[model samples]
Target: MSKLRNGFIVLLAVFGFAFGSLSSVSTEAQPVRTAEAATTAQQITKINSTLSAKNKAAKKWIAMRESGRSYTAKNGNCYGRYQLLRSYLHYNYTKVNQEKTANKYVAGRYGSWTKAKSFWLSHHWY
Candidate 1:
């Protein structure tokens, strides 16, 4: 009876250790690509010329121009997560400029609750 109890305890301990090691290995092996990082990388690329002649910068600028205070447009339009506003449409001459400006603005408004609301009104994703 004593031997059986000791064996069962050893089995449970080994199982626990195995599972813990397996979980750690899996987590370490799995590349974690955040939705934001992936989306930004994918969306920031320029579209094909057949689709639109605009470069990545141009598209970003247009998105910013169209979006308003909440980084949303007049009609159900949301550009980037940053919620760039339409008021800044002509603010920058290039898309890269627009992105830079947006980065700065978002960083400044990081903790504001109104950030999402201002961008959510039209529910437009540009």
Candidate 2:
């Protein structure tokens, strides 16, 4: 009788622990809506500002703007906020503006057109 009682108690304890652990465990992943939205918005803004159809001057600006703001990682060789280091300029901008470097240097960073224009106005080198 005692052996049977002991076996039952052990089984109950094991089940209780398992139940407790299962209850404490979360099954669903929580979504970070705000952060995700901000990131997505930024990407969309970047695409619209830089990647979409551009005029010849805009394309030239993206390629050649080699001012200080143009560096990508600050550690790696990323030359522009658009991350154009050497290859992009060499392939695209250099030939476009063989006479001047003005079109090559970045006049703005990753911001709205207004912000970029403001940066250009203030920095004089963006």
Candidate 3:
């Protein structure tokens, strides 16, 4: 009787531990989802403000090609709409900062967003 009771207790503990781990994983995932949602909203607003009306479509096309307009997008060391190196962001992943950085990078590298889009078209990367 004692061995049976001990075995039952051990089984109960294992089940409890499994349930607890699952609950914690779910709780942690919620915050990641929320952050992703907020990043998407920020990307939309920042992209609208950063690109000139004439260049908006081209810039949008580039961003879509790079990240599908997702601010939280990542590929290896590249991140965000422009696929900037993670080091360039300096841990500041805000939309305004990303837009500013992307614009500066585009201006320096391609002279304009349209040109950048052209480059991307030929090379499949910008």
Identify the candidate with maximal lDDT. 3
lDDT of 1 by residue, 1-126 (tens): 999999999999999999999999988766555665566555535312222333333434434545532332334332432345545544433444445555445436532223423443345432
2 against 3, candidate with superior lDDT:
3
After the best TM-score superposition of candidate 3, give how far the Cα of residue 56 lies from its true spot, in angstroms.
Answer: 1.4
Candidate 1 lDDT for residue 13 = 100
Give the best candidate by TM-score. 3
Q: Compared with the true structure, what per-residue lDDT tens digits does model 2 show for residues 1-126?
A: 999999999999999999887766632222466667677666545534543344333443533444433433232554444444555456343322221222234333433334344464577434
Taking the candidates one at a time, how many backbone clashes does each contain? 13, 11, 0
User: TM-score for model 2?
Assistant: 0.23
The parts of candidate 2 lying over 4 Å away from their true place are: 27-126
How many backbone clashes can be found in candidate 3?
A: 0
Candidate 2: residue 11 Cα off by (Å): 0.2
Ranking by lDDT: 3, 1, 2
* TM-scores for candidates 1 onward, in order: 0.30, 0.23, 0.60
